[model samples]
Every structure is written in C-alpha cells, then in structure tokens.
Target chain A: MSTSPVTARLDRGVPRFGGFKLAIVRLEIRRQLRNRRTVFFTVAFPVFFFLIFGLNNAYASDPIGRGNESAFIMISMALYGTVLATSNGGATVSVERLSGWSRQLRITPLQPSAYIAIKMATSLVLGLVAILSVYIVAAFTHKPSMPLGLWFATGAAIWIGSLLFTAFGLFIGYLLPSENVMQLIGFALMLFSFGGGLFIPLSQFSHPLRVLATYTPLYGLNQLVHYPLVQGSFNWSWLSNLVSWLIIFTVGATWRFKRDTARV
Target chain B: MAERDVVPRTPPALELKGVRKDFGDVHAVRGIDLRIEPGEIVAFLGPNGAGKTTTIDMMLGLSVPSAGTVSVYGRTPLDAVRLGLVSAVMQSGGLLKDLTVAETVEYTAHLFTGARPVDEVMERAGISLIADRLVAKCSGGEQQRLRFAMALLPDPDLLLLDEPTQGMDVEGRRAFWKAIRHDAQAGRTIVFATHYLDEADAYADRVVLIREGEIVADGSAAEVKALASGRAVRATLFGADQATLRALPGVDHVEVHANSILLHCADSDAVARYLLTQTNAKDIEITARALEDAFVALTGSHARDESVQSNADEVLR
Candidate 1:
C-alpha cells in the first residue's frame, strides 16, 4: 500500500487542544441541560431545598443569628450546589464508564486531559447554574443583600468546592463497581445534607456530628462561603480547610484513577 | 513507486506481543501475539468466553494487560490517541442516543485534526440518509451503521470492529461489509470479530481462531479448513451394503441405509478408489471441506458430540 496519503495527513500537524476541550465542554453542557432529569436534579433541586428551608425559618420571626437565616441558607445552598455537581457529574462519569463510552473515547484523538477537563468544567457549570438559581431566589424571597466582593467569593468557593467534592465523587464512582454508584451517591448526599448541615444549620446538629462536619468538605464550603456572606469577613481557616480537602481529593482521586485504569 | 521515494516506516500498524489479561484468577487472554501490517483485514473468531473481547480491549488500551505489551504505530495503545491513530467500533454502544447521528459523528470527528469530513464518513458508512435523526430513533441496524460512521470519521489508519454485525439484517450486513471492503482496499488496516464464519471467509484476508485464551488456528479460510485434514463423501447407492461400505480401507466411519451411505475419510482419493471398485455403486459424490466442519473438528470431537447429543435430545423431546 502507498504511504503518500498517510504522510500527507500526518503532515497537516496535530490539532490544537483549546477548541477540542471547548467542544467537549459544550457537548457535556448540552447533554446535561437538554435532559429534563439533569436540569431538575442539578438546577432545580437546590432551589426547592432553599425555598422549603427558607420558608420554615421565615416564620421564626427571629431566625438564627438575628433574622440572618437568609445569609446562612445562602451558604448552605452553595454547599448543596456542590453536592448536586458531584452527584450528577459522578453519575455521568459512572454511566459512561459502565457503558464503555470512556473506552470509546480512548480510541479517538481526544486527549485524556481534555476529557477530564470537560468533566470538571461540567461540574463547575452545574455548580454555577445551581448557585445562580439560588442567587435569583434569595434576591426575590429571602431579600438578602450582599456586596459584590462577597458574591465573587461565594462563586469562587462554589467552583472550588464543586471541584473538590466532585473529584471525591468521581473517585468513588470510578473505583466502586458501576452498580453501586447510585447507592453511594445517595448515602454521601444524606451525610452532607443532614450530618454536615448543607440544608440546615450546623447548630441544629448534636455536638459530635457538628465537630465531624468541621472536617468534611461540605462544612469547609459552608464555613468559607458563610463567613463572607453573613459576617462580611473572609475566614483564613476556612480557606485552609477548603484547599487542604481539595489537595486531598485531587491527589487521591488522580492516584486511584491511575491505578484502576492504568495500562501495563 | 521508487523505493527511494518512500520514507522508511519502522513500526507496524499494530502489534500485540505476549499480551494477557486476567480478571481476578480467570485469565481472559493468556498470551496473544499478533501483528497487523499497514493494510490488512484480520478476523478474530472465537466462541463465548474465548478472550476475543479481552484481547481487543487490551489492544484499544481500555483494559490494562496483566502482562506484556500492545503497541500501535510504535506507540503503546495507551498513547495511540496522542498519535492520532487507531479507532474502534466497540461491542457496546457508545453513542449518546439522544443526539442526532450527525452530532455524534461530528463530535467524534472533531477529536482529531485532518479527520474526514462528517458528511463524507456518513456517505461512506451509508448513513447519510439518517444524519438528521436522533440516534435512538434509528433502527438497530442503522444505529450499528452510525457507530461505524463515528469510528471511521477520523480516517483512522487502524480500525477494530467487535461483532460489527451483531444485530444487522441481511441487507445491513451486506452493506456494512461493502463499506469495510472499500476501506480495506483503500489501505486501512482492520481487525474484526464475528461469529459468522461466512463473513470471515468472505471478507478477511486472514482469519485467527481463538479458544480458551489462545489462538488455535490462524490462516486464510481455505488454509484453516484444511487443518481438519479430512474429506466428506455422501452417496445414495441403491445396491451398496452397509457392512461392505464399512469394510472399505481408510474409511474412518460409515453410516448406511437402504438407499444411501455416508462415509468419513481422511483421504478423498482413497475413498474414490474404494468406491470405484464396488460393482453395486450407483451414485457417488465427494465434497470439499467446509469451514464450519473444520471449525467443529478443530474445536474437538467433544464439542461435535455435544452438538449431536443436543440435536438428538431436542428431536426426542
């Protein structure tokens, strides 16, 4: 066979990654947004939780921290946004892996970094969409006022918080058999929302569980984002906590993924 | 083409050397050694639990090999994507069923620079007509064809197809093979797996039969069939006696009835000579070895006996 055509093709040079990753990101966003289920779970679920909890606290007349319950719920809502991102994103990855879609991608010229980038980007978009929905709801119903700096801080925290926990979620989904992903996601969400005060305030929990929440990613996000939203100050300890957990999840997840899928 | 005009290419299109995959203690692929040149169609044939999928998985770098190495274009299969080489139509459906056929194919094509145009690939795969429809809305056969379109959109030099026609109707299968043959003739290397012996016999330049984690036979259709080393003779002889037919030399087995006889022999000429000597012989015909028969024989007498036993049991029940 002649090599001329192949040589010509090869000589065209390698593709740039910028457009490829963007395309993957676009595709991922399209797939999730187009699905009514995904939109409901990732975008609408957090809003529903916010309204339910906010309405209940509104009747207290003097909600926790002097009618500052709106600020507190805003932070909790961001944490719930992280949970939404991790659960939905991890589920997507798990389904793709189980159905051999990831295997199919390995054969294409789609770089692994590009693929992972799109997934992380997808998680960020989910987090962003969820947080934005809460922002809209809080403005109309809760009537919470915040400086632009705090809003930026909240958004940044949500993005990083989603990245950290979504990595953890991905690690669990990738390492565990596909059949167990949904069960694990449900369990993890329960732990975060009820035990770590993602929907309710941590003060409502008993002492030991509240202490345990201090070490969880959800607690770190709540503390980090809540400080700026409620007290109008950035907590350095919260930053340390969030970054530490991000390092742990990223390193641990990357290592586990490599060990599980590495080629001999 | 002058030799001087061609650049020296050091690596084969794909190679699997001593590759093995183990899922817990069960060895899926024991030790596979395969080399596909620049442009060749290699068919992998095996029964269930015969490591064909595992081997293809290793070659595509989906599952890590328990031992040895797999390389494509001198790079490991893990890194083949970086080299913009090799593509596959996996046994599992990988397309997002919610997307249109064109969307899936375009998404796949966008993964590589210099990929074939989406329309061209769809045309080549005979799926251009269904380009606008959602993948899930397509018929099973059309979905399979669209999968081929996605796999081929990159104009990958090496294509791996696992049971490409598993659900296709006759016409779909024929159309699929037509596209594959055109690709083969255009110098695209392919490794296809199928249970259909005729597909392998008709399309593949070489067929490799794998069994129990090892390659049992590898050759052209006729060459593999010849491994059985026997000829079949069936005759409806009016005056031949069963006992007399059994007495013929070199005949391994003989079944006789009132008007016909079936003889199994390793040598056709010897059987012909014996039949000619029979004065009562009225009708005789010799048949060439068939791939199906060769496959059954190569798999061993136990398998054949089990098949026979099952048929008999079915009839009796």
Candidate 2:
C-alpha cells in the first residue's frame, strides 16, 4: 500500500518521442513501404487518373485563377493519393489488432499514445511520398500549370490533412472487423472523395447536394487544399468542419484503442 | 492469504490479492490470491475455461480485474509493463505473417527503450538460423521461437508465457525448453500457464493448480501430486493376502493378481519397505503419480483421465 517504493522503481514519466519512439516510427514506415500492393495502388491509382485527365490539351489551356483546370485536377489527384496512402497506413492496425500484435504490444513498454504518434508519423510519411509521386508525374507531363507558391501550399495542406484522417482510419480499424476493413475503408474513401467534391467541383453539383457536400468529412479538407488555386471566397465554415472532424476522429480512435486493451 | 500480507521489505515479484475478472454476468475468475517471489518459476495448471488466461490478462494489464489488485514488484501491471519489467510469449497469433523473422524481432525491439541486442535475443531463442524466413512461411514451431525471441528483447525481470509449448513437436518442445532453461538459471521470475502437466512438472519450481476459477492446490510439484492422491506400489509377490496388505501402514487398497500385487497407498516408501521385508515381493516399483494424473484428479471430470494414457509413467524403480 506504500506508494514511495513502487513509484521509485518506475522509469520516471513517459516522454514524447523519447527512447525507442522514433525507432518504432521508422519500423512502421518500412512496413508501410513493404506493403507492395498498397503502395502500388496508392501511387498508381491517383497517377493513372491524373494521366487520363491532366494530360488532356483541352483541360490544360483552361485557366481559372493562377493555373489551368488541369492544375486543379492534379491537386485533386495528389490529395487522393495522399489520403489513400495514409488511411491505408492507419487501417493496417486492424490487421495488427486481429493478429494480436496490439495485444503483444500491450506487454511492451510502448505507451498507447506514443504508439498512436508513431503510427501517424509513419502514415504521414507515406502521405508525403504519395503527394510527391503525383506531383512528380504531373511535372514530367508539363501539362498542369499553377503558381509555384500554390503548388507547395496545396501539397502541404493535403499532406497535413491526411494526418488528421489517420485518426479516422484508426477508428475504423478498431471498430470494424479486420477481415473486410480494407474494402470498407476503400468504399468509404470513394464516398468521401465524391461527397467532399474532390472529383467534381461543388459548383457542378445540384443546389442541395452542394450544400450537403460542404458538410462531408473530406469537403473541408478539399476546400482548404484547393483554396490557393481557386482564390475563391474563404469560408470560416470550412475550417470549423475540418476541426470538428479532427476532434471526432481523435476521440473515437483513442476511445476504441483503450476499449480493446481494457476489455471486461 | 497471499504472501504480500507478510509485509516483506522487498516486494515480491508478483502479488495478486483476491483478483477476479467478470465478463458481464459470467464470472471468469472468482477470486485468486497468489504471491510469487523473484527468481521462482511458477506454472498455472488449469482446464480450458479455468480462468488461467483471464488471470494472465489481468497480470499483463490487457484487461482490468472486476475486483481486487494485481501488482508486479509492487507497481500496477500496466506500469510494470511500461517500465519494461515484464514481457510475455502468448499461446499464438502475435507474429506478422508478412514480416521476416528478423524484421519481426527488430520491430518488436524498437518498442522497448532498453531492449537487449536483437541478434543476441534471436540467438538466445535459437532462431538465428531462420532470421530471413517470412513468419507465414516458417513452421509452427519456428514461429513460436520467433515469439520467444521478441519476448526476450526487453530482458524483462519477469516473464509470463501462456501455453508456450503448445503445438510444438516433442523435439521442438525440448529445444524451446532448453532456451528457457538458460534464462531460468539467470535468476529470472517466470510464470507460465499450460494444460500440459508434464511441462509444469518438468519446468516449474512450483505449481498453482487452478480449476473452475479457483486454486485447488499451490505447492511444489511433488507436494501437489501428493496433495491429490497416493502413489501406487506394484510388485510380484506370491501368496499376498489382501486383508493383511490393507492392514499395513499407509496402504489404502490392495489388489492381488495371481503372483503380482499392486498397493494403492499414501506412503509408497513405507509400503515398499514392508513388502520387501515381510513378503516375497520382487521387481518392486514405486510409481509416484504423474502431474497429469494429479491435474485430472484436481480439475475437471474423471472421464477425461483415460484420455491421458500417454502421460502415465513408472517412477522410483
């Protein structure tokens, strides 16, 4: 019942990115890259879409603000690739949980928060790589034209946003059955992209649908990333929607992660 | 009562006080109070749903006990784990199939702040030869060794293994235990759960036999066996009278078959001594009951006793 001796033997307090935290992140990154099918799909899927649309001469010449419609299309494709890579990275925990690796981890010194941080870092690294792959492909084609500043901003926005959504991916991973999690996440990705007006402009949608699109999880992200390219009116609502979803995803993920480790 | 109440200066390696777990209306662990000192190897012998795993879960901090406390070196289970004082090799399914054996060890090692050298632990677990093989491609025994390698990373003060030798062939099992024996010699605290009583008898210094969420007996291997039932003394003795044998000290039952007699008795030594001096008994064999026999006698129904024929053996020849 005495507290002093027990606390004395304790290894002090946990530090953020202390000890083997960075090492774990590096390992996760390696694991993510080793998943060849996911890597192929994540880069190839968006790159394939960009090739079909961004390379078209008609779309190339069509300018809106600082760039042509093709530039906008490239940004969208880059965002898709980034999200695909990161979400896949996060959702891989479903397999880890099902395989009892998470349970295995429970016996180790790795704190769950440190573990979540490691996972996000690894996913975001892939997200960064995915953005560059599409951008690199777009650059070689010399078809998409945008301001240099917009290019960096949009890519950063997309990459950072993907970090937030890893929480959502992790939440889904813990909540859903591991067997069909990847497929369900894939379907969810498609639904979110379309609903958030990533594939098509919200202006192209019917009146009610455009309003509904504004409320979707990806809509705020889509708008935030494309804001520099379009130079449209900045809506405060967009930032709020994004922040709200971040809060939701973070809360849901940590809750689910804790529940499994603290079973009845 | 657990030894924790003795108020020793140095806390015991593991202390459980009336620890119980409940899954809704079902009580998985009714109550358990156990204390294990450092450097002792203990085995939890139990049936399928006898709450061994549940107790282990509570000890690993994988689940909270519905009541009471479980501490390692006086700290909480989670705290003990987070301090890298404890590690486990579970029964199965902790390996990533896609990862090569080395990668699996390296990845697991990265989770611990002060993990021992990956190569060293791999060699210790006798898994260095197959380091490049993917876990999915490895045989069942190989994968289990890989898990052992991972568990060894932190050089934990206490090691808990749940059915560590389950699914292993006899040769593989012996090899695995050889690795464990090397660790046991280093004065590490080890607690393992297993239905394989031979494993318990051979490896554990002390056995805590559990059944239906209760500890039926907690003692040394021989003491637990003695606690369950008496040993049997069999020999060839012509003209042995059943009534006279029953009258002998420590002899409970006497059965004569032609020129042979088998005495079921509490004290095999006393019965054997009397048979040698008084009767014309030869080929004298005092067979102590196997832990498997004691396990069956302690847990579950008598029906399953016949199924463990392979476990029977003669002792004290």
Candidate 3:
C-alpha cells in the first residue's frame, strides 16, 4: 500500500552492466566451469593434447625424428588451446540462441554489441587461460626456453592465432545447429591438430600432405609461432598466410551474425 | 476497473495495429488490432496454439511483425525497450539458469535508472529466503516469481506476461494474483495471456479472446460474456423424454448429454415454468451464465472439446 520502499529502491538505481547482460555472462561462465565434462573437454583437453604430442615424442630420446619436431609440437599445443577456447565460445552462443535466451535478451534493453562483446571477451579470456596453462607445464618441466623474447613472441603468436580461431569459431557457431556444436568442435580440433603440423611436423609428412598443410590456418599459425620461438626469426609469408585466413573468417563471421539478427 | 476512474484521458499504453506474423507457411498472428490504456490489465484468453504467444511476441518486439505496427507508450516497442518503459515475463520465466535469485534481481536492477533495489524487489516478489540459491534449483513457482521480480525491476509503465502462472500451485497462484492486482492498482498497464478464465475474471479490467489467430471477442469480463446473449434453465427431470424437452417454448437450442438436458432459452423464468408444467421435472435451476459458459457459448462448442481430457488436471491439479 505504501510507496516508500519501492521509491527508495528506485532512488539507488541499477548498477552498470551489472544486471542483465553482465549477469548472463557471469552465469554462463559459472555454469560452464561447474560442468566437469565441459571443463575437462575445453580447459583440460589442450593439456591432454600437449601430453600426447608435445612431451611423449619431443622430450623422449631418438632426436624426435628432427630438430624442428619440438617446435611443431609446441605450435600444435598452442593451436589446440586456441581452437578449443574459440569453438567453445561459439558453441555456448549457439546453445543460448536456441534455448530462447537470445530472444529473451532481445526483448530487454541489451544492445546487440553488448551481446557480441560478451562472447568475444569470454573467448579471449578462455584462450589466454588455456594457452598459459599449457605453456607453464611445457616451459618448466620440458622443452625449456631460456630467452625472455621467445616467451613474449610465443604469447603474441598465441594471441594472433587465437584471434583467427575465434573468428572461425564464430562462423561455425552461426552455421552449426546447437545439438551438433560439440561434435563440430571436436571434429575441427582433430582435423587441424593432425594434418596441420600440431601432432607431426610438416617435414615428417609426405610431399602432398606437407604441401596441403601450408594452406590450412593451423599450418600458418604453426609457421608464425615456430619461426620466432624455435628459429628466432620472423617470416612475412607466415604472417600473410595467417592474416589472409583471419580476414576471410572475420568477414564470414560478421556477415553471418548480422544476417541472423536482422529485423527484416 | 476502479483504477479506470483515476486516469481520465490517458493514451493507450500499448497498441498493436493490424499485426501479422507467419512462421514459414503457417499464419500465426493475423491482423490483430489491440489497445490497452494506462491503469488497465487486459487478459488475452485463448487455447494453446491460438497465436497468443506470437501476438505477445510482436507486442514486445521479440519478433518483428510481418505486417502493421506495434507500439508501446506511444512509441515503437523497440524504442520502449531503450527507454526502459516496457518489461516482460516470458513463458519460460527468462531467469538466467546459473545465477542465484539475488544475483538475477540484482543484475536486472542495473538495467534501468529507476529500478527497484535487489533486496526490496526480492521481498516484494516473496523470494527473499531463496535469494542466495540458484534460479535453476528453485521450484517452478519460485522461478515464476523471480521472473516477475525481474520485470518489476525496471518499474516500466507497461508489463507483458505470457502464461505468468502456468506452473504454480493454487496457493502460489493466489499469491501471484494478489501481487499482480497490487501492481495493477498502482496504475501500471499490463497485458497477460492466461489459460485460466478465473484469472481474467478476477484481475483483468478487460479480456480479449483469440481463436486461430483472430480476435473472436474483446471487452470487459461481463461485457464479453454478454456476447453469448442468452440465458438457460437447467431442470432435474425424472423419467422424462429428451424429445419432448426439445419442443419447449422460448428454447432456442437443446443439447442432450448423459443424464441432463441443457435447454438454451432467452428467458430463464419462462423456460423454468414451461419445463415444470410440461415435463413434471422438479428442482429447476435458473442461473446466469458464468464467464466460462459465456466463453463456451460465444466461441462455440469446439472451444473446450479438445481440452476436456486436460480440464480435470488443469482445474484441480
């Protein structure tokens, strides 16, 4: 009957991005982290890949078949983290869209930019975490790098590589059905990790596979990261290759999302 | 209805003009012209799949209308969203699955400049005790309340709800109705779709009935009921022939089902006397049609025929 309480509450006002959209992101992250299966597949899957590809062969004897093998394995490990994080971000977005959350948010005052920004931020943070988690184990226990510059370059390479993967992931998010998101992420991870010099270096493959690997985004990232970290040199060809894939994927993702949300 | 006395010439808080939506080949909402003035609660009444949701969706700008326009508070619904002048409680309850009740309300409290505080809205929504618990873990009733709280947070002039109490128990439903009435009395415009006729009767200042994507009836509860435009005298007859009952005076229609005969007539008193004199039936009951009977009569017999199986569960459970 009295208006004092409602009026008093109104006087204090809403927090900045603290309610709807921000809350949605926090809730999404918490839910994802709580799901042990998702956590393992996303956060811990890269670690598993690192163990199988980076440590077993490169850290063992027999020269790992070539001096460049460890560099290839590190690239594969970093690629594994970036791909997993970016794909998960897309999958999460698609699931929410199918589950009616997107429509619910559409009715609210939340802007489309805020919606896209949240997903991008979540993916970047997840990518950084995955990259750091894998690199820490690699640097100290095995394949130790002595120089600070290589570490910095490795971080930059991972960031650039992740940007491409995240863009590709966004494209996949709009293309795939919500029910098939997990399967798509898994399929892409395996395809790139094996043929793109993540598990086995390009030099170890046949002439055809080696040539095919150079055209893949994963291969471009491998070359970009490998040149600076292992050979201590930058390659313009590798940077161009990565940027070309990045441009293609970014354009595709932006176009797809705009079409999906348009009023007409 | 009493609140209608307060605001004299207020423009409609919500309006839908010739709105239409087609999902692929199926026409969902077809040419709906609706208007609700300030301080009025209008209940949208319809059976399932009658385009009630699609209509509400267009009104809230969740789905763009295929034809015509939807406006809220004299502006487009999309603009209303930007001004925080419209809020909604969707059928799914729209609560973030992982956040606790407190977090959901607290977060929504941040979306507007004049939103109610987290604690105050929680108490008002009667979810203060479950504030720290995750919304997904709450009971259906609690989740519904939490959604209403989220809608309330913005303190908007127009509130839209879809099946707002679909899953609540009787007591919870009663409490929810009380809150809704309180808000309506406070001069907020509301438009809600509900399956319960009593909800429309008890809380709504106006009721609109939609059937197969068309507006079949629209008016105040009694005014809409008046669309049936007839009265009936139901008599308890012993050893009477159904054939003779059909021939009674002032009777327009006669339906024979199981043990009783429904005599649809213009004058209840005339029919009662005629039934007593002709059929020798005692205990004749003469009564005006309730909203349900009026709704059935106006919408025709096909309205609740398919719902008979679920009617028991819908009424008692």
Candidate 4:
C-alpha cells in the first residue's frame, strides 16, 4: 500500500490547549443550551422569583440596611440565579460520567485540566446569562434605586462570588451517584438559599441560628454581593469565608475528578 | 500472507510489556505481553471476564497498568492518540443521546486537528441515512456504526474495536467487517476483541486466544485449530484387553465403558481399520472435532494449568 496519502494526513504535533479546548467549550454550551429543564432552572426560575419578590409592597419602602427592600430583594434573587446557573452548569458532568463519556474522553488527546476548564468557562457564561436575565426583569418591572457604581459592583460581585458553587457542583457531581444527583442538588440549593439569607434575612433568626447561617457556603457570597448595596463597604470576615470555601471546594473537586477518572 | 511478508522496520503499532492490572482482590489482567506490527489484523478471542476490556483500556490509555507499560508506535498510548495514530470504538455508551448522528460526528471531528470529511466518514460507516436521527433513538447497531464513524474521523493508522458488532444483526456484522477489511487493505492495523469464534476465524489474520488473564494460543486460525485437531473413535468390543486397546497405534487416550471403548486418536481411520480387522468389535464410529471443541479444549487446559500453578504456589508459601 502506498504510504504518502495516509502519512500526509497524520497530525504528529502535540495537542495544545487552543482551538481544541474552545471547540469542546462551544460544543458543551450548545448542548446544554438545548436542555429546556436546565434552561428553566438556571435562567427562568430566578427571574420568576425576582418578579414575585421585587413587586412586593411589604419590603418596597422599608429600609433594611443601606438599600431599601426592593433593591435587597433584587440582589438576593440575582445571586440565587447566578449560583444556580453556575452550579447546574458544573453538575452536567454527572450525566457525562453516567453515560461513560468520561472514559471515552480519557482515550482522547484532550487533557483533564482542559476539560474542567471548559466546564467552568461554560458555567461562567451561564452565570452571566442568569445575572443578566434577572437584571433585565428588574429593569422593566421595578428597578432597584441604588447608585450606578453600587449596581455594577453588586452585579460583578454576584457573578464572581458565585464561582465557588461551580466547584461545589463539580464536587457533588463526582461525589454522589448519578441517579440521586439532581434531587440532592435541588434540596441542597433550597437549604443553602434559606441558610444564606437569600430568601429571608438572617436578622430575623435567633442569635445561634444567625451565627450558624454565617458559616454556610452561600453566606459569604450573599454578604459580599450585598455589601456595596447594603453596607457600602467590604467585610473581612465575609472575604475570608469566600476565600476559604473557594479553596476547599476547588480542592474537593480536583481530588474527586482525579479519582473518578482513574481506572475502575 | 502478502501483508505479513512486507515487515516494516519501524516500531510495532502496539506493544504491551508484562502488563498487569489488579482491582482490589480481583486480578483482571495478569502479565500480558503482546506485540502487533503495523497493518496486521489481530483478534483477541476470550470468554466473558477474560480481561479483554481491561487490556483494551490500557492500550487506549484509559486505564493505567498496575505493572509494566504499553507503547503505541514508540510513544505513549495517549500521545499516539493525540497524534491521530490510533483511535477506538468502545463497547458501549460513548455517544451523547442529545445529539443527532451527524452532529455527533461533526463534534468529534472538531476535536481533532485534521479530521476527515464528516460526510465521507458517515458514508463509510453506513450511517449517512440516519444522519439526522438522535443518538438516543438509534438502534444499538446504528449506534455502533456511529462510533465507527467517530473512530474514522482521525483517519487513524491503528484502530481498536471492543466487540464492535455486539448488537449488530448478521447483515450489519457482514457490512462492518467488509468496511474493516477495506481499511486493512489500505494498511491500517486493527485489533479487536470478541467472544465470537466465527468472527475471529473469518476476519483476523492472527487469533490470540486468551483465558484466565493469559494468552493460551496465538496463531493463524488454522494453526490454532491444529492444536486441538483429532478424531474420536467409539466401538463395542467383546473380551477386549484394556492394555492392548490402549497400545493401539495412533491412540492418544482411551476410556472404557461397560460394553464400549472410546478412543481419542490422531488417526481415527487407522484405529478404525485395526478395530474392524484385528478385534471382534462392532458398531464402530469416528468423528472429527469441530472448531468450537478446539476452542474449549485449548481454553480448558489453560484453566487447569493455572489452578495447578496456584496450588503449587500455595504449597511453596
């Protein structure tokens, strides 16, 4: 057999993380965008919550901290959306793992780090969509009356701070069995939302329960995103809490990923 | 024969050196050493739980060996795959259910550097007709064909298929092997694992029979068949001396019943002739063993040898 045509088509160069990684990212984004259930949870659910809570008359004029109740409710809903979008994005790994696609990828040239990076990037994009969707709803219905700087800062803080949940989602995706994954995630999301003061402010709770709420993973993010709008300053405790949980979740995710991809 | 004679001087397409894999207390593969030259079509024939998938996983770099190493074209398996030197069609569940057949092929093609044209690959894999069907809706045979298309994307020089036709009907199996033969003619090395004796006999240039995590036989189909080639002679003889019957020419083993003697021999015709003329024997019958019997006999002996070896090791310890 002549070798010229076959040899010419062989790509001998080492694979780099450029176009190939982007291709995977694009593929994942397109596939996830088609899932209507995921779209509802990550994009629409939070917008609905924002609509219901932002239009309430109970907290509309009442002063909580720095911003009135409407602004506070809007920020809380936006944070809820951001966390859900990012975590749900990362949680898609469970489906891939269950289908044995991860093993298929192990045989390919794509590096594990590149795969994780693509998932995280996709999560960030979804988080951006969620935040914007909530903000758009707020703009049309009842826009929060806060300074422009504080508004941008709050949005930026919510987007960046919600990244910890992406790692958390990956950790759960690898840690739990696939069958119970979504149910557990939904239950945990509700618990975290309540405990982190997203639905109800921690101030109403007793001293001990309020203190416990501060230690939850979502608590730091909630406080950080609300700081500029609610307090107009950064809290060192909240920053430390965010940084520590970030490290913990990132470590947990990497460890679980390595173990999951190892030979069964 | 024509392909084997042109032995290229370059490194083999795949080489496994003393590879062993242990999962907790279960030893999946134990010390497998194999080499397949480029353009050679080799079949791994084994029964269930015979370590075929584990070995294939190591070869594809999806699983690391507990001992020894695997080299693909003088480089690591992962590197060889990265360079488009090798690709594989796994046993099951690699395709995403959400994507259509054509979309799956397109997405895989985008991952590689210079993938072949998606339309041509779909045609070659016989999935062009079902290009728009979602993977979840495709039948098992169609999904296998879609996997074949993905493996063809890189135009790889070496292809590994793990039970590529497991769920395929007879016609689909025939078409799949025909396509494989076409690729082999273009000088691509193919290694496939299957439990089907007919598939190995019909498709492989060399059949490697594995049993209990070890290679019991490796040769051309005919050559391996020769290992268990013999005939059985059963005859009813009155007043036959057991020693004299055992001493009969060409007889390898003898088992006596109440009214008959069964003989396993290299030349059943000779034994039959002796029994008819020299002894008061009646109702004599001779029959040759089938390839299935040969496969069983070959694998059965290996199982016995392994047990004996383990017993000896126990004694030594």
Q: RMSD, model 3, all Cα superposed?
A: 8.5
Tens digit of lDDT per residue, candidate 4, span A1-264?
322222323446546683256666677787878878778887798889877887787667577566677888888988887888788877878888888877776666666777788888988888888888888788777556777677788899888887899998899888875856866887898899988999987999899999998888888889888887777567788878788889998999999998886664
Error of 3 at A177 (Å): 3.0
Local accuracy of candidate 2 as per-residue lDDT tens digits, B1-317: 56456554667889999998888898899999999998899999887788999999899888889999999888888878877788898999977887889999998877776678999999999999999988899987888889889988877778999988888877888999999999788788999998776778899999999887888789998887666677888999888889999998877678899998988788888888888898788999988655346566544443454345335533322
lDDT score, candidate 4, position A201: 79
- Give each prediction's DockQ, rounded to 2 decimals: 0.39, 0.39, 0.23, 0.31
- For every candidate, the chain B TM-score is 0.73, 0.75, 0.72, 0.74
Per-residue error (Å), model 3, residue A40: 1.5
Show model 1 residue runs off by greater than 4 Å. Answer: A1-9, A12-20, A55-68, A179-183, A232-240, B1-35, B63-79, B132-139, B213-217, B226-294, B297-317
Interface RMSD of each: 4.9, 4.1, 8.2, 5.8
- Misplaced by over 4 Å in model 2 are A1-20, B1-8, B231-248, B251-294, B297-317
Question: For candidate 2, what is the DockQ?
Answer: 0.39
- Residue A262 displacement (Å), model 1: 0.8
What's the TM-score of each model vs. the native? 0.77, 0.83, 0.77, 0.83
Question: Model 1 over residues A1-264: C-alpha lDDT tens digits?
Answer: 333333214643456773365676677777777768667766677778767765564442344432356656666775676667656775666777766677677677666667667777787877788788887787677445456566678767666667776787777767675756766776677676665566666788788877888777666666665665555556576677778877887787687677655655
lDDT of 2 by residue, A81-151 (tens): 88888888888889988988877877877767677777788888899889999999998888888888888
- lDDT digits (tens) for residues B1-317 of candidate 4: 56556654477788899999999999989899999988889999888788999999888888789999998877778777787788999999987898889988987887677788999999988889999998999988889989999999888878999989887876788878887777677788899998777788889999998877888779997776654567888889877778887897767778888889998777888899999998889999887755446466535755575689899999999
* Tens-digit lDDT string for candidate 3 (A1-264): 111212111233323552335555665566556657666765687777766656664353233213344444655676677677766775666666666667766766767666776777777767776777777766665554335666667767776578677778777777764757867777877787666677765789889887887777776777666665456546687778788988998898889788777764
Best by lDDT: 2
